[model samples]
Target chain A: MAHLTYFNGRGRGEVIRMMLAAAKIPFTETFLTERQPFEKLIQDGLLPFKQVPLLKIDDMELVQTGAIVRYVAKKGGMYGADDKEATMIDMYYEASRDFYSKFLPVLFMKTEEQAVKDAKAAGEDKYFPALEKRLKETGSGYLLGTSLTMADVGFLEVLLLCVEFGGDDFLDDHSDVKQYYQRLVATPLMAEFLKSPFRKRKNDEQYIKEVKRVLNRE
Target chain B: MAHLTYFNGRGRGEVIRMMLAAAKIPFTETFLTERQPFEKLIQDGLLPFKQVPLLKIDDMELVQTGAIVRYVAKKGGMYGADDKEATMIDMYYEASRDFYSKFLPVLFMKTEEQAVKDAKAAGEDKYFPALEKRLKETGSGYLLGTSLTMADVGFLEVLLLCVEFGGDDFLDDHSDVKQYYQRLVATPLMAEFLKSPFRKRKNDEQYIKEVKRVLNRE
Candidate 1:
């Protein structure tokens, strides 16, 4: 049995959870709150990188989120079978990484104003347009060749974060990106997941709220 | 025949070049100076991401340095064939990415003091230890299990970058990482490649020199 160790809500662990749910894979969701098992795991070999979202597959433990997601995606048949589609899937996955790399550091900042400013300049100005263009180029609506791969799931998670942290109007300026976000949210599995009780802004809500307040003040 | 497009130096393109040279794969190295064909390519496709180090197979273009490296690694048989080895390879590759994510941004900073401070805090403090731990855990001396894989090559590239940008004394603080770098550099194929005229940091000399200057500044 595969065991996933993460915090209460979906953050780095969301894509893996969603993939498992969609594939009907039975696994233990070990939420590491500030409590018993969490504290124990932190002290033990579980927290190898001293980070959460670690996947325990039987005996082997995997740490990197990308590796874990790809492992799960491969098991779920969400990673494309053909080489071309797989390459395309990889392209989208890396592109999402590129997008996140631009804005992720901002979230670590103490000031909400600085975070919003950085997001606007980097996320809105640079990443969104590039993503929009790539989406259009794909021509199949999906980020990759045709089917919903892990790339789609990864992008959906990022888009969810954008709405939750960057606000409802996060996609207001980029129509294509906004449309893509809407399409993603409307997907049946995604919609259900979004409505599920498990869907909350894990450890990030305070930062999101603070950023929103700063934007209002500005 | 595969075609690699990048500037004259071994910036992101070096590993692919080395892999091809080791495999004796016939590929055209299209150096993009302020030249004609490069200008035509710029006007034609614009590199999808507007980045160098793109690989073109027949008509299709593949972007992203990691993606390109993986694709080439597969072609060169540097990535493992079996599932378990592949997973190990994936782990090392992911670790290399994690290491770079911490240090690459610091290299791009304008101020020398700020760059060194950030590198010390993030690069030396956070990344090096993580890499060292992984190297020790592998127990194979090479990054992955038993045999040398693309992960080792990828990591060697990162370590080489540290030495190039941070100077020879860069990895002096971490004995294991230093040993791993030396071991990688001693590989006959890698050693031969290093002796090649193409291995000189001529094209990227200015960037490296600036980085070294910043790193060495008290």
Candidate 2:
């Protein structure tokens, strides 16, 4: 059995959960919602880099969310269609990862509020459109190819986060992305996950407040 | 033929170059030493993310350094010994990539100098020790397994950069990492590359000065 350890929130662990679900793999989860428990886990040497979304399968342990996602994807047969497809998927994944990094400061902002917001706005203008372009270029109803790969799962998470922080119209300028977003959420397991009450429970008040404040430029 | 394009310096492209050399794969390179030429390539739609370290293999063009590194690692048979090994290699690669992300602001620091430098110092203190522990535990003379994989290649790059900025004594507290570093460089093609004058030219004057100043804590 695979065991995933992360915070209660869906911050970085959601993609892993979604991947496992898609593959029909059952796993246990241990959420670290407080500082003390998480610190204890770190002290216990459970985390490699002292970060969460750590996955343990039997005796094998792995860190890094991206790495874990790919590992699970490969195990579940959701990695990509082929080597070229895998490379393309990874390219978009890294690009989305870059977008996530920029979104983080604003999401957790305490200072230079306006500057950070403006930079995020500029980033959205750049990256989101590039993604939209790729969607059109591929025209495979997904990021890389026909089937839903790990890239789309990660990409959907990023898009949802962007919408949370950038407003509903975040991808309105790019019709393809908007449509792609709908198509992604409609994936069988993901769609079920979305409409489930568990989705609502996944929401953290503080997180919502931070995202709203950043979006509203408050 | 594989055509790799980036600036003349190492920045994100060196890892790709190292992987190619280690695999003994011959490829052509196009270096954009100036802003104008690089921008022209971006405008020409050569770069997907408008970023450097773009790899063009045949008709397929891929971006993102991490993705490119993995792609080359796969093609060169340096991906891993197997699926589990690949995941393990990726785990370490992502850890090293995270370390690289923290080291970046300090590398390109122009303001908030002391605060950034101090954070970088704290980061080094935390991550390097963890890496040292891994090296000791694995005891395989390499990061993941007995053979040299992409993880070692990427890890070596990060260590070299850390040493460049934090001085050679950066890894003094971590003898295992120190020994591992020597083992990496002593690889035939890598050693040859290091000895070649081309390595010296790969060093950008601005990069060295910036790194030196940060290490001096000025």
Candidate 3:
């Protein structure tokens, strides 16, 4: 048992959760709503940096989403067994993080136009090309090697987020990324997860719609 | 030979450079001095995400500071050999990244008052305690296992940035973090790194003074 503490939305927490699910790891998720508990957690110093997506493994806790994802990936055997492959997996994961750092801010915007403009300028112009090039270079289809690594899991979520929130057509201009996105969606576990109750929520639809809109615009 | 491409600063590029020095790996440091070249590289689609601190291995390019650090650490044998130990090493490196993310904005600020307020309210109040607790929990003195890992190297740079810019008294309240800083400074390689001509640049001191003045008010 692993426990993840975060808000209800996917955001940073989704990648680790999805990785765990794909790997068949059992974990409990504790979602905090409202400012009171968040403030209380801060005052009590329960959170390392007063941030969420903290992973609790038994008595020890790990903060930082990247670290948490890596920890979980290690447990799930998603990180390569060998050092060289592991390094490549780590590289891809970091690239995904860099991509998220740019696109995440745009998702929080209240209006669709602002999100589109930001995504087009940053997401389409910068992020997609880089990811497309990386995918093409790998030639293995997966972001890391033949099998899906945590990097693929992480990148898939971001691609989903872009289509789910930024708009579906966001990656239309970049064929490799689009193809990669389609391949990721075609995964049995991921496809099943998408069809679950988790994907039917209003917020989820809104995010997906926004992502679709962004894709269409492009 | 490894090649590092970044702006002429210690910023994100320092840890990689330091790791190479510690391991005695000979690598070319390609500093981009002008915006024109930086822009040109991005326009040519050379950069992954159009950012600096990219590591070139043979003909392949890698991005993300965290990913690059781990890759170099593995290559340099700075990361642990065992699975569990490597995970632990990664844990601390991730924590160091968390600390930097919290306090970096303060260092980048133009005014002294804002810098101090940001540090005290954000850095000291939030970041320091978290690091202090981790230091206390480690019990082995070093962040991970008995020997040094890239986590320590990365944290050393971050601590140096905080103290060199904010002042020794900046971490005065957090005894564990303070002791850790002292321990880092005691290392011969680190000490020599500190005294290098790179540390004496006028811009470095100016940035420190500016941030310190802001911290002083708080």
Candidate 4:
């Protein structure tokens, strides 16, 4: 069985959860809601880097988000058909992930300044258009190749959260991305997971407090 | 032919260069000394996300440092012998890389304050101790397995840089890591590469200025 330990929110852990859901893999979770328990886990040598989103599977405890994600993706056969294709998948995944990181702060803090908001919103066109260009260039109905891979999964995962942060019309400038996002969601696995109970909620003020409590920013 | 394009300094490009060198693979390089030429390359659509350390190999223009490193590791037969081993390699590599990132700002500007200096130095004990624990647990002389892999290579790479930044005695607290570092360096492949002209220089004031110019920090 796969078990996940993180906070009550979906910061770094959601993507791993989504990958599990999409693969129809059943997993349990433990939420570390306070600093003491988090410190205890670290003290117990459970976390490799004293960070969370730790997954215990195959009789091994895994930390590092990138490593856990790769293990899950490869296990689900979502890496790619071959090495060259896998390289492209990784490139797409990394690019999408880099773009996703810009919006991560939204989960913990609310920015009211228009300048900060504008600067954050500015990343959409700056990064997504290149993704738009790739979708148009590939014409394969996938990011790099025909079959669905972690690249597509990662891209769709980030796009959904970007929409959550940027609103329904977030992809207004990215027609191809919008279309691709829809196409990915309609896949049977994703369609099921989207409606499943494991789907985490978008952040709210209450949840932000919850996350802040876990972050324990003094 | 394997071709690399980056700025004159090592920065992000040196690891890929080392991996190639360790495998006795030869490659040519193109250096971009100015921002306009970089933007021009982006305009030409050679870069996936308008970044450097672009490697043209196997007829693919690869970007993303993590992805490029993965490809090179796999091709050089240094990834590991199997899936579980590769996962461990990924973990060690990502952890070491994360630790390396905290020191990257040293390349762009001078950090003179003792507090910042103290904080940077603090990371060595926080991180390398965990790595030392891993080394002791494995007892393979390598990081994860009995044979040398990217895990060892990446750890050594970061340790070398950390030593350059921190000093020769940086690993005095990490006897296992210190011993492992020496072991990796003494390997025939790494020993030769260490003496080769390809070994990049550490960041100096002039190199920092060069990097700042390429970064175009105004």
Q: How many residue pairs clash (N, CA or C atoms closer than 3 angstroms) in each of the candidate models, in the order given?
A: 0, 0, 22, 0
What lDDT tens digits, residue by residue, belong to model 4 across residues A1-218? 89999876677888888888766668998887677888788889997677788999888888888888888888888888788988988888887787776665665455634433653454553567677788888898788767677788888887786666667887776788788888898989888878876677776676666566766763
Q: Lowest summed lDDT over 10 consecutive residues: which window, candidate 2 chain A?
A: A209-218
Q: Write the per-residue lDDT of candidate 2 for residues B47-162, one digit (tens) a residue.
A: 76767778888487888988888888888788787778898889888887777766666555434356456545754655666777778888888777677788888787777776
Order the candidates by lDDT, highest first — what do you get? 4, 2, 3, 1
Off by over 4 Å in 1: A8-11, A22-26, A31-43, A109-139, A165-176, A202-218, B8-11, B15-26, B31-43, B109-140, B164-177, B200-218
lDDT at B34 for candidate 3?
52
Candidate 3 ranges with C-alpha deviation above 4 Å: A34-46, A57-60, A110-112, A197-218, B35-46, B57-60, B107-109, B197-218
CAPRI-style class, candidate 4: medium
**Deviation (Å) of B208 in candidate 1:** 8.7
* Candidate 3 C-alpha lDDT tens digits along A174-205: 88888988988888877877776433233455
How are the candidates ranked when ordered by DockQ, highest leading? 4, 2, 3, 1
What TM-score would every model get versus the actual structure? Answer: 0.78, 0.85, 0.82, 0.90
Question: Could you give the CAPRI-style class of model 2?
Answer: medium
lDDT string for model 2 (A58-162, tens) is 477888887888888888777786788888888887887777666565545534356456645755556766777777888888777678887787777777776
Give each model's whole-structure lDDT.
0.68, 0.73, 0.70, 0.77
| TM (B chain), model 1 | 0.75
Candidate 2 stretches greater than 4 Å from native: A110-125, A197-218, B34-36, B109-125, B197-218
Better of 1 and 3 by TM-score: 3
Q: Going through the candidates in order, what is chain B's TM-score? A: 0.75, 0.80, 0.77, 0.88
Q: What does candidate 4 score on TM?
A: 0.90
Cα deviation of B55 in candidate 1 (Å)?
A: 1.3
